[model samples]
Target: MALPTLDDPFYYLANFHTVLDWLGSRYADLLSAEERDFIAAFEALPRASRALLVRMVMRKGVDFRASRLRYAEIGDTRAAAAPLIAAGWVETDAELELAALFTLATKGELAADLAPWLAELGLSRSAGKAAWCAALAAESPAPRALPAWLPSLDDTHYRLTVDALGERFRLMFFGNLRQQWSEFVLADLGIYRFESVSLAASSRAFSRRDELEAYHHLHRCRERFDADEPLADLLAEIPREPFDNPWLERRRGRLLYKFAYRSERQGELRQALALYHDSAAPEARLRRIRVLERLARFDEAWALARCAENAPVSAAETQALGRIVPRLRRKLGLPRGAAAAPAEPERIMLTLPRSGWVEGAVAAHLSRDQAPVIYVENTLINALFGLLCWEAIFAPLPGAFFHPFHSGPADLFDEDFHARRQALFAACLAALERGDYADIVRRRFRDKHGIQSPFVAWGALDERTLALALTCIPARHLRLWFERLLGDIRANRAGMPDLIQFWPDEARYRMIEVKGPGDRLQDNQKRWLAFCAEHAMPVSVCYVSWDEGGDERERQDAQGDEGQPQGAVIEDAGAPPNSAAGGNPA
Candidate 1:
């Protein structure tokens, strides 16, 4: 049977199952041991019970009403939830109630929504706590007395114990815990001190709050990093507290890597190199190599490239070294007699009016010709590459210690590595499989359910478009192409063609880069164009120039050598004057 359309409820249903399958299989490692155990227990239940459990778990808040579970397909809701309730995952009849004083405190915000009810009760309209208390005393339901297991406190509230807090932390750490009850509870407590006076007075009152405090520190560091703080200041002031966990280590490494990255961007190569040495992030190492080259330390860069090429941790790293080595050899004035060249390079380069003009014109032209064209540039390609090497991109490694923010998929380097080559190959193969690519892509982006991936914003393409792309691009070719593209995922992920034209029926696609008036190709764009040319990937650079409209004054200016547009469009023609072989100097 065919898949359902995007608007169909069955589509969401099927996609939900797909997410579950991915969680159960691909992301099993992300869950804690306890979470895995809970999943195992869930699987062991009867089908209806399992469904009900899933519904409960996926539900928004902690205290859902019994009426909310009355879904027709899950049979008797109470019977279905029997196992969960017995397992202490759910509780009933021991409901908590708000104090009269608390109600009086929040009566203003509540009164707006309950205006009709308030008016029906003939309560005072005055905005005073005394009036609110008086009205509540007359009409409010009596607070229930505490059961034997509960504390008999009337004026005070309860707080989560350290163990309970830790449990919640674990859930948040694993992406399962949510800020549901805390959102309302914190908002309701105006200025109350609920914990014991003794605990509050003690120096170790919040000793067990180390994990939470560490996470808070990590967040502060992230903010400072985002604000572009100096590497020296950041190194000195960033959190030194250690959680001794793999996740925290990864997070700390990622933060340090960010500092190094900022240094590199600011042209402080020596300082950046020093910072890179402290990180195990692949991007840092790759940057170090590039910085060495920029500093004209070719021999050092060459040595590092040789070592990385021999033992790459990820496919992206290996691919980067492959490109770097060749370029380094060229930079060192090595001969290229043995390397094959295009017999007759027939790639095209055209002159348009402006950079913006090139994109719109090319996109419109391609769309008019029955081709689905998208201005993906970096977002789509990077996202695809990221997913294909997610494991390597987020793999934890030893680094100079900083604090607790375990690097997740946010960091894409191994010190200088990109992705594990073998795993990348596997991912590409999986991507080519029928239904797998769509499922994986949808699941990753949480399409139609959660946060959608901005990458897949390509127009006129959905799961159908991706399926067609896999058929055309194929796993093997896609693997080879992406491997060559990852010279440095950090750098190569950008400067891609501004437009992509895909012909679904023909199963063909071409990338087009746009250049405006007086604009020239950047180093990265030249490298990408050269790579495409070498591998027979259809790509072009459209140089946009202002149209003169045959005006005499404009014609005079246009006649000048500087004003005249240069470059030829090769349409099944012989090699142009400056072919791809001679074009890219990067």
Candidate 2:
């Protein structure tokens, strides 16, 4: 049935399909023929009529009356559109007689559709938005969109505020404000750079007993600063002699160095170090240690650490640094030493507990008939040497150990990389059998060496190597092998179809994870867990830690029902992830 078309752009109102098409097409860069016809007729509609059509279409999607009770929200459609709705939109709603009297003032025949649609329009923001949009379309050049009114008070305000307040204020206000603000705008505004400048200025002003302003005004360098230039004479008229005086008293030089080190200025740290040698005040000494720590100069930090007897530190300082001792030991390449006990037997090696990928690495060696452990002896020696160096390098600073190295430099500690490393390595191997790569920093990863000795033979018959020999087997034996693990996936896959890879080289598959000394699990171990769980196979986790007294080998296992769990591997049906128990029976 053809309802007479109105002049309003919704002139195509008679065709509901055309109205929906128009709604969808509004988002499109290209409009269909139906939409073109509708727009053409719509352009001829009166302002009020066009507004009504826009509101009607948008309102049909929501509940209006309850919306008024649910959200008496201000600046919204429910309140503004109520006046038109009370004018008898529901036909039977003669309930609002007072509203009827108000609409009676209108000159035209009160349209039945107007009140009902108006109620719908009141139900949603879309309805109100549509009305505003239609009005915008009609009054184009008369008034632009609301975009021209809001103020652009963003970073520029902070910059101006900082300049007026001075250093201390800028540090407190801008640093706090920048940290609290979101990462994007704050970082993009160069807040951190401003912060460093503010802190430097604040340190100077505070030391001079200057009153802090509400904001900080700091000099900003347009380019990177060069420490080689005479800073005091070049930038400010301040005399460097008194300010930087070494044994002459005022702590300005030391304080400035502390500020520079905290701000990560390398040039500043070097300057601070030079003055430290000349005066070595308690504060200067601490700054020297702090700067060295920040630069990851453990040995230097340790050296300064010994002179800290006169240094007063809070109780909290000791507690905080206590956690860093282990990390320090590792960073200095200290040997973690041997595990207390023989680790449990496993086809897999202990990794640094990672989450996603497989654990342990098993590279294959192919020969005529035997792939029997060719890579074992080389791997052992590599570990022994790394451990030896770690033990020698990580130690507390000594009082008289500033003695010269027999190899060359008197102060080998102050020597550069090329000079120190060779000396350091030579010092570590003074007790062990030394030859060729013996005094070298690098541990050999491959054992293709022909000349064998006690050191090479010691790693050859290691207990961990013996365990790998027993537990690991050919990839073809994985199904039977996984039955020993505790996880569920392998057990469930016993009677079901499963995809499997038969690795012939290591004589073991990727799933036959191993555990050995000093190896930690990385993030990839979850796959092993899930793989065993999917196939209902058992999973075995081997641990290699001291077992109090005797140092025992330990293993834990988890298992479940067989033939693929009820809903095993629900994701991609492309042969069900990986099952531990065995190969695809299909």
Winner by lDDT: 1
Candidate 1 lDDT score at position 298: 97
Indicate the worst ten consecutive residues by lDDT in candidate 2: 153-162
**lDDT by residue for model 1 over 383-485, one digit each (tens)?**
5554554444433332211111222322343333444444544555466554466455456444322212222333334454455455444454455556755
lDDT of 2: 0.32
Candidate 2's residue-wise lDDT over 373-403, tens digit each? 2333123323344334432332212211211
Clash totals, every prediction: 29, 68
**Clash count (model 1, backbone only):** 29
lDDT of 2 at 527: 35
Candidate 1: worst-modelled 10 consecutive residues by lDDT: 196-205
Local distance difference test, each candidate: 0.51, 0.32
